[model samples]
Target: MTTITSAQAYLVDIDVETVRTDAVQAFLKQETVFVSITTSDGLTGVGYSYTIGTGGRSVLQMLRDHLVPRLEGQDSSKIEAIWMDLFASTRATTVGAITSLALAAVDTALWDLKCQRAAAPLWKVAGGFRRDVPLYDTEGGWLHLSQDELVSGAIASRDAGWGGAKLKVGKASHREDLERLLAVREAVGDRFDIMVDANQSMTAAEAIRRAHSFEPVDLFWFEEPLPATDISGHERLARATTIPIAVGESMYSIAQFREYLERGAASIIQVDAARVGGITPWIKVAHLAESFNVAVCPHFLMELHVSLVAAVPNGRYVEHIPQLRSITRNEMAIKDGHALAPDTPGLGIEWDPDAIDDRRVA
Candidate 1:
């Protein structure tokens, strides 16, 4: 029986090269928290979680003060049990970002250990549904970009063989948003997919109004138009428009996703592995979405999400928001409009220890 011998947590702050502005907020930096676990068999696994520009220290504290201590001497293979126990120990913070993020760091490390022990890549070990998932570029679609820049970026993504590009909506005027969408549509032509995300900046009535205006452009999906908590608003918007409502990135638990799925509020499930806890619960959420006949196009952290997307049958697209390049040794593999899952075992991320150490803040 391999037992966890040690568990440690660290924090790093990585800056975004380009300004990333959406409707709701500006992403200043990635406050990444990492957990490293060593087992009695001498196998070590690393897992990580992140916040856009805040809360990394809190997540790190949660790990150091509560979660990591409980991990020592536990059976390394009992990932679910460990996850539940840690979660229950932090019951006051359950179903929230801090607890979930801390659990993600530890839970993902356990998954890394599980994958290494089996001698298989995470995608294959997790489900083996597909090796490559279609790619969509959000890097070029930020709301801060000029209309011409947006058009050029869409065309550029198409030229590079990416399947789709997402545009940030929720501009000052509905007409302005429509104009930009129309311009990109006119430039990229009819075959390419174009998506729009409001970043949860609109109300139910406003979202329905904007969805009506956006219908002529043939958008692939409308993402996070209303706050994630507004399930009834999303339900009404979903019924009011032909465009599919996509959400789940802001969500923190499986039960939250179930509410959206059962109410027919979300058509595409964008489950972020870090935000939803870790690969354990992330996979559960994916299977749950599959049962509802919904496709998953998870939010950011492309390095991790690519494998998760490839591991599930219903994973439709991997959003391309390259945020990990500075701290990782390799870029995600992209070919012919798709992101390929790494064939290597143990989470599939080639983390640069030296770079991580240089950026360590905790």
Candidate 2:
């Protein structure tokens, strides 16, 4: 067997047709995280990780400065040790969107390498849990979207075959958010599943207040009502509202997610594979959430999450945000509405090398 060798980073602007904007923020530009890992025998595996708007530079810096040094000239097969090294090196930064963003890149690259070596898609290597996960269309739930726009988007999503759709909430006032949600509910009607993402904008009282207002609507779940750190707040919101409190897109590790689960903080768990270390940790999260009988609805990376959700029994929905269409060789397939996973080697995440050639940060 060949010993592990070198790792390098590349900064690419994955061209997207449009910037995905919502109450959270805007993409502003096309960007992605690309990593190359080479073994002693000359077998190189390519992996991918990405961020939406901010933190691209930080991801590159972390890899160029802190992470690559530890992995260079080491056995790539020793994944666990390398993961530990990276985790410890960045521990001082602690876990947040930033740390998790960096880990997402490295972990993704490593998984690509592993899949290439084993000659299997990520779903198989990670243990083929399922082939079909429930799908939800994220119809660009922008903060700027008017009530009419929100209703139209939801109906369009339903018409397109999506099982549900996520709408943005958390404006300046809880009452305002309710008015918008009610309009959307009236448009989409009672049969469709309507979820909401507050994007960490509300205080606990506001989250509770807004949640109660949506009770007549039969909401699918309430997402990111408050900061990920305030576990007690989330628990309070969960207990106070009949609506399910869903979190974990900003959370980075199993330990953190375990805390959410232990506290009964979330009824619907939205784990981001990129944010929660990588496929390894993401799978760990899915299983842990399953043990508690919590629903698993992974955040973003719909192309990646489709496969993951299919493999996990409790997996719920893969968010469908069609922003990576220009850069990816295979844009996630949408039939009616559910996003379909590609049956290809690795993650089925091959980008147009030439399209990324003109990528620019400035």
The digit string of per-residue lDDT tens for model 2 on 1-362 reads: 44558777777766555545556676575457767777787777666667765677888788788887777777776677778788898888867666676777777777777777777777767767766566786764667778788888888887777788888886777677788888888877888898888889888987887788878878989999898889999999999988888998888889988999999999999998888877778888999999999989988888788878877788888888665666667777666555666667667777677766677453
Summing lDDT over every window of 10 consecutive residues in candidate 2, give the lowest-scoring window.
15-24
Error of 1 at 46 (Å): 0.3
Tens-digit lDDT string for candidate 1 (1-362):
88999989999999997899999899999999999999999999999999999999999999999999999999989998999999999999888999999999998999999999999999999999999999999999999999999999999999999999999998999999999999999999999999999999999999999999999999999999999999999999999999998999999999999999999999999998999999999999999999999999999989988999999999999999988999999889999999999999889998999999999999
lDDT of each: 0.95, 0.78
TM-score of 1: 0.99
lDDT of 1: 0.95
CA deviation > 4 Å runs, candidate 2? 14-16, 360-362
lDDT of 2 at 38: 78
Residue 238 local lDDT, model 1:
95
Clashing pairs in 1: none
lDDT score at residue 28, model 2, on the 0-100 scale: 72
